[model samples]
Target: MVLAWNGADPSEVGDGSNYELGVWYRAEVDITITHLRIWTGPGEINVTNRRGRIWSSGGGALAVITLPDNPGDGWTLHALTAPLQIDSGTTFLPSYSTGGNYGALPNALNANVPSADGNLVALSAANSPTGFNGTFNTDPETFPNSGFGAPFYGVDFQYTLGHGDATPPRIVDTSAIADGLQVTAAAVVEDDEDLTGLTLRIDWGDGTDATTVTYPTLQASHTYATSGIYPLLFRATDSSGETANRADFVQVFGADASSNRLNTKAMQQALASHAMVLGNFKTVSLHEPRVRPAEPLHVALWWSTITPIDASGLAVTSARVEWLLRMYTPGEQEPQDEMDAIIGDATDRLIGSLARDFDLDDHVVDGLVRMIDIRGAHGARLNAVAGWARWSDGMSRVVTVTIPVIVNDVWQEGAA
Candidate 1:
């Protein structure tokens, strides 16, 4: 299920001084649970890994405030979720307070919530006199991006329980596969949480690529403009953003009374297990673990194998993926020569030590994986660093490079 939080103001505020979210501001909240049967008083909600809470004011109202400065969560600042529990068939109208937790509470939204509606249920507001707005850059807003300038009672991602249907994708029906144009697609998309991106593999019968949608479930059909019984495949992403290959949707084109039946119906092998390495941007040291002068920067490597492979013996083959170096803005003098030296050293290390035997296409999930650190030799540069990722042997090639980054001073990425 998709949860969206948006920011706005009440009609009563004429000066628009409300919800500016200055240094601090408490918020009114209304929460609804769809397709579930559960109820309880949520003491607190999590936000940005921080925690916040709502409580009953002396005037039969709910009050929200940031956790103690110490927050007891072992963090100076936390990402918290606001949990304003509303009872069954009851509307909860929460008001903001002029105080944090110790002072008097004042509400911005008139505390007239209609909770008694049989179809209506839970609601509460967790606010601090302090504002909980987060900064933002330009992008047509979308889910995953928490609302700007406001907190949804401090919540990130939450899945409604039992909102998923345990079903893999299937190709229930389709029209005849054609020579120049053949269409194949999923028979249905169903889920408990809620269906998400659904993808279908389409083979145009020629050597052209197997058409695929990185994000599926949104489209209903795929057309191939070439001839051949391109083995078609199917994969569906679940509400929680998990993906699964639906081999049941495998089909073939060019199948007739002339060809061998099995060969005519080759499954979309391309829709095999997939893997993705998660990446994040964080503040880190420029030396030691990741980047080192005149040494290969050994970065933490992780991956989710999409296709199943017996990597018991496959060695990881790597190439000079990325070679980069960046420091603060400089003067008229350039550091090009220093950068060339740093990158040149990194290339030597990659050519010698990188794993050279493995089938990346058949990567097994949680199977044998490799990790290396960029370290220095006897006497190396103190601050220069270079890094790279393993590459496939011109086979199973996706992007041009494994560590698709190279050159020092080319990126501001201090951490990989």
Candidate 2:
């Protein structure tokens, strides 16, 4: 993804009158490259190994004009018939020249790029039409007092890791533990390229339906209902259907009713149910109500419990949990994704009104309030109870509520 030349400069030109101009780029380690961007016209453009062996050519029929014709002014992308693996430190010389007199398009020129390898540009003696056949650094050469001010031409390149790599993803780590009611198994998956759309399948040895998932995230977790020593298997498959797997990867032990703790399975099920309910709402445009693809929502749940005490502990408060919900609009890529974040404040009019005696997770409650306030048709079904106390010492139980929300991407789509 690196560009060898500056793209922001608003100037571009072909090799004026000169027979040829080229840059010799030294490759670092072995690289598999697919294409290079160059400004070309009626003449030929070519790549040669350190020994000057032709590897790729844009034109044919070696008249003076050997490369293909470029019809436009900007840099044109020329695909190398296939990926070529070049060894490290190998000098790759890419050049463009005038085969039929400097008419139409010459090679692209980045006039004053001081960082260019000045030694790589070779010129021809006057009237020497052959490429790179003449003098070096003598034709209109600008050698500045500062070593960094010499001019260089422009070139860009692209490479891919999937070129010749056939190895499958490897499982780096695995762990399992009994959390409340279920056994949670986690695995860390990795690949040479760590690319997207790789399929991961988790086989919970307890005969549960194996889960198949695809995402770029390396960490994955699954919970089993009942527990014994359940062996787990993780299999990863690339787009090429080449799969690498780890068998009997991990063993998880489940918990029983006697394990005194908040029910993890119940908590997971509750959160999953809430996620499904929120995902069911269709996006409604503020101008007109219409259906569109639903955006992805992330739900996080955290909780803490307190031990209720009394001579007769019949009215014991069990636990308190918080749910945080987020929505990612489609076409909103990371790093460049624009987000409108609304921090939930105790004094914010819209969310502050919802603060009753019930102690809601302020963060999650604020996100829910913001989700509903966006410009669109929004609705929610919520139930809650204020702090209810039933004790001689008067310790109130914190009430929790369920709130489902759908984030409409109508604005994002319009912006796109």
Candidate 3:
């Protein structure tokens, strides 16, 4: 609700006549004034911008109105209807026959306004809605001493600025984690766009999921209650409204008590699958090839990997592993090579031996079946028939395919 007055000085009367105004001049183009008047007192003071903004009180600070650029002698004829700081109105007319230079003021509108306390209010100006900000140190108005026209009404205005790829997700380690211990298991989530918005989720491989998790720093310490394998999954999102999800597997094997009884050798090759089954390898009996052992019991193998972990990338060397296969007839006091021959078939001769269960902490029937299997799908023995595959499972895992040792008429194999 910016108002304008069109004269250098307020209309004043000293003795018999009112004060005459100065010549005409332009302020902003297209705006003009012919008659103007100024009286003292308070009245309704409205402030607004392009749209109506319902506003609060001025608190006595007046919405100082501006006068026209071309002030003339007819200014004194305009009369006031109200006071200085309040709402008041008085129409002005041209003194001469030529009439005043402009038409009447436009409609009163409303707009949005804010208080000095930072609270927003509704204001009206030209019957539309907009926003207005109130400042404490508003500029004081000064009645011009001498000028062709008055200044135009203006308000300070200020404007908020705010500120994310197709990067695909990747799988780092599809392995498993142990239980009852603080295992650092995690994956990294990334995006082609802004990487900040990407969130990481952890499925803990323990049958529970947590979306509040994030990646690149996946360090969850959840212990499994029982001994089993667990699989972990992860997903990511970007700021550009793009999402890339990735999932890797991990296992968390548990025991009756947290101890180091697990075979670390076998665990290295195991991949976690849905929190179940770790160190995915099997063992049994088969007739394939025995490099060092006698022809009585041969060995078959299937695996993959250019260089096995033990081979250390082409350092090619033999790996010896121990097998505890129950001789078809244990404690018969016969040599292992002879027993392997006496043993018969696919029907019932072979069994998942737990013969040592009769005793405590001691291995019963044992055989040293050396194998050539490396580490991979094809190289891995599991890729072949599930025979009594005997392969190394530790740092120095060795399967000694015993060559027939007939000493002093006593054909006895090495004690495992």
Task: Name the best candidate (by lDDT).
Answer: 2
TM-score of 1: 0.28
Task: Sort the predicted structures by lDDT, highest score first.
Answer: 2, 1, 3
Taking all chains together, each candidate's TM-score versus the true structure is: 0.28, 0.28, 0.26
lDDT, candidate 1, at 388? 29
lDDT of 2 by residue, 300-324 (tens): 2333222222212233223323332
Q: Score residue 76 of candidate 2 by CA lDDT.
A: 49
Candidate 1, residue 133: Cα displacement in angstroms equals 16
lDDT by residue (76-182, candidate 1, tens digit) is 22212332333432322222211111111134222222222212312223232212222111221111112233322222222232222333443343333233344
Candidate 2 deviant stretches above 4 angstroms: 1-30, 33-56, 59-168, 190-199, 213-216, 238-242, 248-416
The TM-score, computed over Cα atoms with residue i paired to residue i, of candidate 3 is 0.26
Where does candidate 1 stray beyond 4 Å?
2-158, 162-180, 196-226, 248-416
lDDT of 2 at 61: 14
Sorted on TM-score, highest at the top, how do the candidates line up? Answer: 2, 1, 3
Q: Could you give me the TM-score of model 2 versus the true structure?
A: 0.28
**Best of the two (2, 3) by TM-score:** 2
Question: In candidate 2, residue 199 scores what lDDT?
Answer: 76
Q: Which residue pairs show collisions in model 2? A: 44-67, 58-68, 59-67
